[model samples]
Target chain A: MHTSGSRIVRVGTSLAVPVRRRALVQGLAVVAALVAVGIATLTLGGLGIAPERLPAALIDIPGGSEGFVLKRLRGPRFVVAVATGAALGISGALFQTVTRNPLGSPDVIGLTAGAGAGAAAASLLLPGAVSVPAGAMLGAAGATVVVFVSTGRGFSSPSRLIIAGIGVSAMAVAFTQYVVMLQSRDQAAVLHAYLTGSLSARSWQNAAVIGGALAVLLPAAIALGRRLHLIEMGDELADALGGKAEQTRVWSIVVAIALSAAAVSVAGPIAFVSLTAPQITKRLSRTPGANVVLSALTGAFILAAADLCAQQVPVVEDLPVGVLTAGIGGLYLGYLLVREWKKGTV
Target chain B: MLVGSVLLLGAAVLAGLALGSNPIPLPEVIAALSGGGDAYTRTVVESRIPRTLQGLLVGACLALSGVLVQGITRNPLGDPGLLGVNIGASASVVTATAFFGLGGHATIWAALPGAFLAVGVVSLIGSGRGGATPVRLVLAGAVVSAVLSAYIQAMTLSLPDVFGSYRYWVVGSLAGGDTDTLLGVLPFAVAGLVLAVLMAAPLNALALGDTTAATLGANTTAIRIGGMLSATLLCAAATASAGPIAFIGLAVPHIVRALVGNDHRWQVPLGLVLGPVLLLTADVLGRVIARPQEIMVGVVTAFVGAPALLLAVRRMRAGT
Candidate 1:
C-alpha cells in the first residue's frame, strides 16, 4: 500500500524492481495488443490478403496487389489512426493531470470544437486563405485561450473549466454549423462528414501530418511526464519539491493543445478517444500517476479498434468513427459522472 | 414587471408576424388576423401566423419548463434541453423517421415518448436513494444527450432521406409549423403549462430544502416527480412543434429571474411570458439576418443564448 506519493520506481538505485517490472510488463502487453489490433485493421478489411503474407506485404516497397492494399489503403489509415490516437491519449493524460479531474480532456474543454470551427471557417469563410491544419491550430489556441481566461482561476477549479468549456463548445459548434449552412449543399455535406470524424478517404498526406506532429509533441509530453506527476501532488507541494508547477502546467497545456489540434485537423474531432483512453490506461496500469505511454497505447488501440469496427460492422459500415466513440464514450462518461457524484467530487 | 413582460411578449408576437422573407405591414397583419385581407396578403399572413403562434407556444412552454426544472434541481444552470429532453426527442424523432418509417406529424408521437423515456432514465440514474442533486442531474443529462446525439448522427448518416429533412428540423425552425400542427400541439403545451403553474407553490416550498419543505407540508418527492413530468411534457411539445430550439429554456429563465426576484410564483409566470419574447425575437432576428434564406431559430438562439449562459456561469461562480 505505497500511497505516500506518486509511485516512483527509481532506476539504478536498486530499491525495488517489482513495481518497475510490472509497469514494463504492462507496457509490453499493451504494445502487443496494439500490434495485434493494427494487424487486424490491416488484414480484416474488404481486401482478402492472407495472414501469412501480411508481414512480407507490409515491407514490400514496389508494386504488388498486396503491397498496394497494405501501403496505399490500409497502411496510411493505420498510421493516421495510431498517430492521432497516441496524440489524443497523451494530450488527455496531460490535461487530466493538470486539471486534476478524470473528465478533463481536449474535447471536454472545447479544443476539438474550436478546431472544428477553425476548419469550417478556413474551408468555408476564408476559402483557401490558409491551410486547414493552421486554421484548426489557431482555433484550438483560441478555444484554449477562451477557456483559460474565462475560468478566472486557471486550472485550479475543474468544474469551472468544464462549464466554461461547455459554453465555448456551444458557441464554436453553433458557429461551425452556421458556416456549414452558409455553404453550398455539397460543400456543406463535405463539412458535415468531416465534422463527424471519418477515416474514409484519408491519404498518406494526412498520416504524415499527424505523424510529424506526434514526432515532436510525444517526446515533449514524455519529458514533462515527471513534472506532471509532481504537480499532481498539489501546486504548493510540487513547488516545494522543486517542480516549476506553473511552468509545467503551461507547457503541458501547450503540448496538449498542439497534439489535439493536429489530430482534429487530420481526422476531424474524433470524439472521446482522448477522454476514455487515459482513464482506461490508468485503471489497467493500476498506477498512481499519469501513465502517458500506456495511455497513448490504449488510445491507439481504442481508435484503431473503433476504426476497424466502423469499417466492418454490418449495417453500420462506413459510419463515421466519431459516432461510435461518442456513443460508447457518452455512456462511459455518464457512468463516470454518477460515480463522481456519489463520491461528492463532481 | 409582469405587465411589462406581457407587453414584450405581445411585441415579439407582432414582430414575428410582421417580419419575414416577405415582410407584411402591421395594418395588413392586423387585417389578416381579423379575417379580411387581400389574397396575397392573406396567403403571406396566413403562412406566418401559424409559425408565430407556434413560436409563442413553444417558447412559453420551454421557458416555463426551464423554471420548473431549475426550481426542482436547485441548479441555476438546469435546463430542459441541457437535461437531455431535447436530444432525446430529437433522437427519437430521427429514429422514428429512419427506422420506424414514421414521418411528418407522426414524429411528434415519437418525440413525446422519447423525451419522457430519456428524462426518466436521467432521473433514475441521477437520483440515488437520497435524491438527484443538481450536479448529478446535469451530468446525467449531458451523458444522455451525448449518446443520443451519436445515435442521431449515425441514423442521419445511414439514411440520407432522413438526413435531408432531419437536418433542418434538428437545427430547429418555426417554418415547418402549420396551423394543423400548431393546433394539435397546443393542447399538450397548455396541459403542461397548467401543470407547471399548479406545481409552482410546492416548488417554492421545496426551495426551502427537502426537510424543511417536508415539514412545511409539501410532498417533496411528489413535487419533484410532478415538476419533472411537466417540464418533460412541455419540452416534448415544444421540440415536437419546432425542433429543438436551444438557449431559450436555459437563458430565458435567468433573464426572468433577474427581472423578477426568485419567487417561483413570480418567476414561473414571468418566465412563461418572457420565454416567448426571447424565442420570437431570436426567430425574427434570424429571419432578418439571413434575409431571403432565413437562418434557423435554433442557431440564432445559440448565438443569443450562449452569451447568457457564460454570464450565468460567471454569476454562479461569483455567488458561490
Candidate 2:
C-alpha cells in the first residue's frame, strides 16, 4: 500500500498534471528492457541472425534463409506474442482494478477456461462450421454472463467471485476435455496444442487478428484508466468525484473480455501472463492504481522473453510458451499468497 | 442413513455391472458372478469386476481422505484433489515416465512418494505464524497444483510418446486396470482407511480448534500429522490406480454432512460408502450418455462436482 506522492502542477482552468517522476522513470526503463528482450527474441534463435541484420531481415524480400526465417517464422511469432501479451496485460489490469483484487485476472475469473471451452467446441464438435476465434468469443461472453449473474454481488467481493470462478472454470475445463475425448486422435492432437497455449507456427494473420482487437480495445482501456483509479476510492466517492463507477466498471470489464478473448483466440489461453503482468507492473512502477500501460509493456516483455526461452532453451526446445509462464506464474502466485498471508489479508 | 447409503451403494454397483457397452440380463449377471454363466457373460462380468472393485476402493479412499482433510483443515472446500495431492501424484508419474523411463505399471509407486512430498510442502507453506488458515491452505494447495500441472504439461508436450499415455491417465478411469492392479493398491487403501478410522476421535476433538483439542487431552500435532499422512496415503493410492478424479472428495463430505451431521464417526463411514456410489453412478452415467463412445468418469464428476462446489460456497457464505 506504499504510495509515492504525486506533484500536482495546475495548468489553466481545465487541465492539471499530477506527475510522479520516479514511477515515470521506472516505467520508461521497463519499456526499454522490453525492447531489448524483443530484439533478443528476434535475433537469438536456430538461425542466429546478428542484432544489426535482424531489422533488415524482418523487412527484406523473400529470398535467403535468414529473410525466410525472419519474415515467415520468427517475426510473426514475436508479433503475436507481443500483441497477445499486451492484450492480456491490459485485460488483467482492467479486471484487477475493477474488482479491486490482485488475483482478478481472466485466467482466475474463468474467462480463459471459458474461451478454451469455446475453442474446443468450435474445433472439435462443430469442426469447420465456426472459426476458433468466433467460438472463443462466444464462450468467453457466455462465461462472463454466467459469472456476473450468479455472483449477484458483482465484483465487490473478491473471495466470492473467485470461488464462483473456480467452479465455472472446472466445469468449462471438463467440457473441453470431454470434447477432446470425443474427437479422433489426430484432431485431438491439434486441439491439445491449442488447449495448452502455443505460439508454434503462428502466422501474420494470427498476429493481425489480435493486433486489430488491441487497436480498438487498448485505447478504450487507456481512456477508462483514470475512471478506474477513481473507482478504487469506493463507488460513493467515485460518484461524488464525477466518475460513474458502475458504468466505468462495466466498460472496463467489456474491454477486458474483448482483449482476453482476442488473445486466447490467437494464441490459445496463455496462463499467468494476465495475472502476473499487472501486479508486477503495479509493484515495479510503484503506482497507487493499476498501471495499465506499464502492465501492457511488462506482459509483452514477459511473454516474449518466455517464448524466446521456450524456443531456444537447449533441453526443451520448441516447448509451448504457456508451460513456462504457468510454471513461473505459479511460483509468483505462491509468493503473492505467502505475502498476503503475512500481511493478514488472506 | 447408513443403511440407506449402503443400499444406494449396492444398487449403484449392481447398475455399474448391469449397464455398459454390452448389457447383460440380471440372471446372467448373477450367474456370471456365481461362476456358472457362458464365456461371453463371464467375460463381461470379469472385466467389470476389476473396474467395480477399483471404483469402490478409489471412491472410498477419496471420500475418507476428503473427510479427514476437511475436518483437520476446517476448510469446507478442502479436498485431496484441491490440496494438490492428486496433481502431485500425476506429476510424479509423468516425471517417472519421462525421465526414469519407468513403465506405466510402476507409476503407483512413484505416485505415493510424490503425493506425500506435495502434501508436506502444502502443509508447511500453508502454516503461517498463527497456523494454517483455511484460505492459506486452499491457496497454497492451488499454487502447488498449478506449478505441478505446468511441469506435467511441459513434460507431456515435449515427449509426444508420453503424452499419448499421459492424457488418458490424467483423466482418471477404472476401465483399464485389472484385478492385479486393484489387488496391488488395496493394501495401501485399506491401511489408510484403517488409519482414518482410528483418527476419527482425534479429528472430532481437533474440530473444536487446537486449544480446545489440547485441553481435551489430544495431541493436536500428532493427530494432524497422522490425519494428513493417512489422507495422503489414501489419495495417492486412489490416484495411482485411477488418474486424478475431481470433486468426489470435495462434494461427498458436504453431501454426507448435510445428510448425517458432522460427527466424524457417522460422516466417515457414510462418506466411504456414498463416495463409491456417487462415482459408480457417474461412471455408469458416462457410459450411458455416450452409447458407443465412453466419456471418462473424471469429466462426469467435474460436471456434477462443480455445481456442488458452488452450492457449498453459497452455503458457507450464507452461514458465515
Candidate 3:
C-alpha cells in the first residue's frame, strides 16, 4: 500500500523497508546521466575518437593510439573523476547529516583546505617526492581536531563549528599561497593547476587510489546512514532508541575525513562539490536525512560533466575542473542562502 | 587611548623605516631620513618611504572600511577582505591587465567598480526577508569571494604573462609599492576617509536597528548607502595600491572596538591609527623574519590574524 511519503517494499517475509518513490527515480536518472557523460568523456578530447570505436579501444589496449588514449589516459581520468566525485559526495552527506546543517561539508569545515595545504607542503617543501595522500589525511585530521577542540561543546553547536572552520580554512589557504610563492614561476604554474583540482593526466594509480577509498568508505557510509538520520532527530531520542548519537557522529566524521582526504590526495582539493552535492541531491530526491547513494551519484555526474565541459572550453586549455565547480557551486550556494532565508530555515 | 595609539603608530613607522633586508641601524635610519647618510643607505631608506606611506594610507582605508561595514551590516565578522571586496578588486584588475593591457597606475580605475559591484551583491544576498544575520552575510561573502577567485585563477593560469604579474599582487604585499601608484590611489583613499568621518553619527544612529534609527530622524537608506560606498572606495584603493591584504580590516576594527565602546567616532579614528601600525609592523617582521628572502605582508597578516579570528569565534555568544 502507498504511505504518505514513502512506500513499503516487501521482499519475501524477512525484510521490508520504506523507500521514497521519487528518490528512486531521481537516483536512476543521475546514474543514466553519469553513464552518458562517461561515454562522452571517452569519445571526446584533444584527439577525438568515434563512439563506435570505444569498444575497439578497450579491446586493443596494447596496440592502437586510440586504445592508448582511452585505456591509459581518458579512461583513468574519467575513473578518478567519478570515484573522487562519489567520495566527496558521500563525505558531504555524512557531514551534513551529522551536523544537521546543510552548510556542513568538508570544504566549509576547513578539511579540504587543510588537505590542500598539507599536499602543498609535501609537494613543495619535502626534499624528494613525499606521499601527498598521507600528508592530506594528516591535515584533514588536524583541522578536525582544531575545530572539535575550539568548539568546546563539540560538533553539537553548528554555528560555532562553522565559525571555527572559517578560521582554519583561512589559515590553510594562506599557508598554501605561501608555499606556492616559494617555487619557481614554472613550477608554481603547475602547482597552481594541481591545487585547483585538475583531472588532467590522471594515471591509473590515481584512479586505483580513489577507487579503493570509495569501495571501502562508501559501504560504511551507507550502513551508517540510518544511524546518522536518527542522530539528526536529537541526542536523547537517538540514544533512547539505541542509535548512540555521539558514537555515530564521531565515526561518521572519521569516515567523512577519510573519504575527503582520499579524494583530495588523488585529484587535489576540488571546491564546492562536497558542499553542493548533498544539497542538490536532497532537493532533487525530495527526501529527508542523508541520502548517501543519491548524493554520490549526483556528485559523480556533476564532476564528470564539469570535467567534460572543462575539456571542451575553447581557447582556455588546461582548465581545472575545480574552477568550474567553484564558480557554479558558489552561485548555487548563493541561491541556497537566499532560498533558506526566505523559508526561514537558515 | 588616542595618545597611546598615536604612540604605537610612531613606533611602527620607525620600525618600517629601520628594519629591512638591508638591516640599517636605527641611527642610520634617522640619519637617512634627514638626508645625511651615504648614497646607497639614503637610497634604501628613500625607497622605503613610498611603501611606508602606501602602508599608512592603505591600512587606514582598510581599517575605516572595516568599521563602516561592520557598523552598517551590524555583523561582527564584517571585513573588506572577508566580504569579497579585495578579491573583486583583484578580479577586475586582472581582467584589465590581461585583456586591456592596463598596468601600473591604471589598474586602480578597474578596482573601484569591481569593489562597488561586490558590495552591491553582498548586500542583496545578505539582507532580505528578515534582514541580514552575521552568519548569512559571512557565508554570502565567502561564496562570492570563492567565485571571484576562481575567475581570477582561470585568467591567470591561461596566460603566462598575466600569471607573472598576478602572482605577486595576489599575495598582498607592499613590496611593489611606488610613488606613482601611491599618488594614483591617494585621492580615492582621502575621499573615502572623509566620507567615513562624515557618516559616523548617522551610522551610530542606524545601529539601534533600522526601524528605531529611522524613527529617530536618521535616513536609514542614506546611511546604509553612504556607509557601503565609503567602504567600497576605501577597499578598492587599498587593494589596488597594495594588492589584497587580509586581516588588517578584520583585526583592526575588532581590536579598536574592544578598547573603545560601540561608539563609531572612537572606533573610526583608532582603527585609522591601529590599522597602519599593524600593517607596517607586519611588513617589518616580514622583512626581518626570513633573512634574505622576504615573506609577503599578506602571508604575515594571515598568520597573525587567523589566531585572532579563531579567538573571536571561540568567544562568540550562542547566537548573534
Candidate 4:
C-alpha cells in the first residue's frame, strides 16, 4: 500500500463478480432512502409551518412563510450534508480499499492534518480558498508521501503502512498546533470551529463549491471505479491481465485523494467517513470489491441524519454534524476493533 | 540493569532540577534544590522544584500506565495516547470545566473519574466474550477517544472563553501550576504505582499469552482487572496534574523494549524509571531550547518520540 510509485494489485476480471442485480436494487433503495429522509428533514421544522404546507415550500407556491425557512436555511444545509457525505464516503471507501487496510482513513493517515495545515497556511501564511484547497491537496500528498516513504521497504505490509501513517499524523498534528499557536487568538478561534469539523454558517456558496466538486468527481469515480476493483486483486495478476498496476493504483489514489480533499475542504477533516463508511457499507451490503458507490450513499445518509439531528436534535444545540457522526462512528469503530482483535493471531 | 536505569533516573532528576528558562547557577540550582537560600529558595521552590517534581511524577505515572496497558493488551504500541486515554481525560476535564465553573485543582478531581469512565467503557466494549485482543483494545480506545475528541471540539468552539486558556493547557505543560496538586494526587499516583509494580508477577505470566498464563496458576480475570484499574488511576492522576501528554505512554514502552527485550519483569521497572527520565529530560530540554518561551512538553515528546518509534519499528522489522 505504501509502495514508492503505486501499490496497486492486479484484480482479475475472471474473479470480478459482476455487480449483481439484487445488490443494485438494494443500493438504489438505500439511495432513495437517503433522498426521501433528506427532503423530509429539509421540509420539517418547528417554525409553526403546518406539515401540509411542506409541499408548497418545496415548489415555492406560498406567500413566503415556510418557504423562506426551508429554502434559505435547510436547503443549503441539506445540500452541504449530502455532498460532504458523498465525498467523504467515496474517499473513505477508496482509501480503505486501495490501502487494503481497514484503519487506513484520511484522519488516521494525517490527511486532515495536512488539510488543516493547508487551510491554516491559506488563512494565515497564504491567502484565498484557492490556496486553501491547493494547500490541502499539497498537505494530503505530503502526508501520503511521508507515510509511503517511511514504510517503503515493506510496501506490501498493511501494518507498516498504518504505523508509518501514525507517525506522519503525529507530526502533522504538532505542526497544526504550532501553526494555531502562531496565529492571532481571533484567527485561532475561527480555526478552532473548522478544526472541530463543523458545517455551521454554511451558505449556498459553500454548497455550490462542494456540489460542483461532486458533479465532477462522482462520474469519474464511477467510470474509473471498475478499474480500481481490478487494482485490488494484486499487481502481478493485474499486470498479466493487461492493466498497468502502477497507473491503476495511481489513479485510484488520485480519485481517493481528490475526494478526501473535497471532504476536508468542506467539513474540516471529519475523519471516519473514509474509514468507517466503506467498512460499514461493505459489512451491511456483504458485496465486496470496493463498495465505493454504496459507501458514498451510506456516507450521505449518515451525514444527512447527523446534520438533521444537529439542527433539531435537542440533545445538544449546534452540535456539528461531524460530532454526531463521530459519536455514532465511535460505536462502529469499537465493533471493527473487536473484529480486528478476533482476527489477530496475537 | 537495575543500577544503570536507576543511575540514569538519578541523572535525569538532577538535570530536571538544574535546568529551566530561569537561569539559576547550577550550584545554586543544587543549593536551592537542597532547601538552601531565601529568595532563590522561593524561586526554586515555587517554579523549578514543583515543575521538576510534576514532570517526574507525571512521567512515572504515564510510563507505569503504559506498561500496565501494554502488558494487559500484549500490544507493543499500546499507550494512553494510542488508546485515547489522554483524549478521554482531556474531554472529561473540558466537560467539567465547561459545565461547572470549576477552576484550578478542582478540574483535576473532575478529570480523574471521567478518565476512569472512558477507560472502563472502552474496556467493557472491547473485552466482549473473547477477552481483549491487541487490535480490539486499540480500536475500542480509538473509537472512544475519537468520540470524546468531538465533544472536546464542541466544547472548544462553543465555550470559546473557557477554551482559550485550555488550548495552551491542553498541549501539556509542566509549569506555573499549584504545586500542592503534586502532593494532592501523589497518594493516588503512589498507590497506583505500587499496585502496578505488584502486578508484575501476573503481568509477567500473562506475557506468555493468556491461556498459558492461566495454566501458570495466575488468576487471569483478577490480574487484568487490577492492572487496568491501576493503569487508569496512573493516567488519571497524570492527566489531572499535567494534562494529557502523548508519546511517553506510546513510545516509552517501545524504547524500553529496544533497550532490553520483552520481559515484563525488566521492562516494567525500566519503563517506570525511564518513563519519567525521558519525560523529565524532554521537559528540561523544552525549557533550554525556547529560552524564555517554553515549548510544550507534549509537542517536544512527539517530535522526539515519533522518530524513536520509527527507528524502533524499522529496527524491529530488520531484527525479525
Best by lDDT: 3
CA lDDT of A269 in candidate 2?
86
Worst 10 residues of 3 chain B by lDDT: B128-137
lDDT of 3: 0.82
Calculate DockQ per candidate and list them.
Answer: 0.33, 0.34, 0.38, 0.34
> Taking the true A–B contacts (Cα pairs closer than 8 Å), what share appears in each candidate?
0.42, 0.48, 0.59, 0.40
A144-240: candidate 2 lDDT, tens digit per residue: 7777666666654555666677678878888887776667767777777777888889999998899999899888998788788887888899999
The C-alpha local distance difference test score for the whole of candidate 1 amounts to 0.80
CA RMSD for every model? 4.7, 4.7, 4.5, 5.9
Q: What is the C-alpha lDDT of each candidate?
A: 0.80, 0.81, 0.82, 0.73
Best of the two (1, 2) by DockQ: 2
Candidates arranged by lDDT, highest first:
3, 2, 1, 4
Task: Pick the DockQ winner.
Answer: 3
Number of clashing pairs per prediction, in order: 0, 0, 0, 7
- Model 4 quality (TM-score): 0.82
Superposed by TM-score, candidate 2 places the C-alpha of residue B275 at a distance from the truth, in angstroms, of 2.3
Off by over 4 Å in 3: A1-3, A8-18, A45-70, A94-104, A131-160, A219-249, A282-291, A331-346, B1-6, B22-47, B67-78, B121-143, B194-226, B252-270, B311-320
What CAPRI-style quality would you assign to candidate 3?
acceptable
Best by TM-score: 3
> Tens-digit lDDT track for model 4 on A1-346?
2323223344675443345554577689888889777767765556535666666656764556566556566677788888999898887776677666555676766678777766666677665545655676677777777766676544344456556666666766766676677667788887666666777766788788788888888877765567666666777777887666667655665676677777776667675666677877876666556677888898888788777777776766676677778877777766765565566532
TM per candidate comes to: 0.82, 0.81, 0.83, 0.82
- Residue-pair clashes, model 4: 7
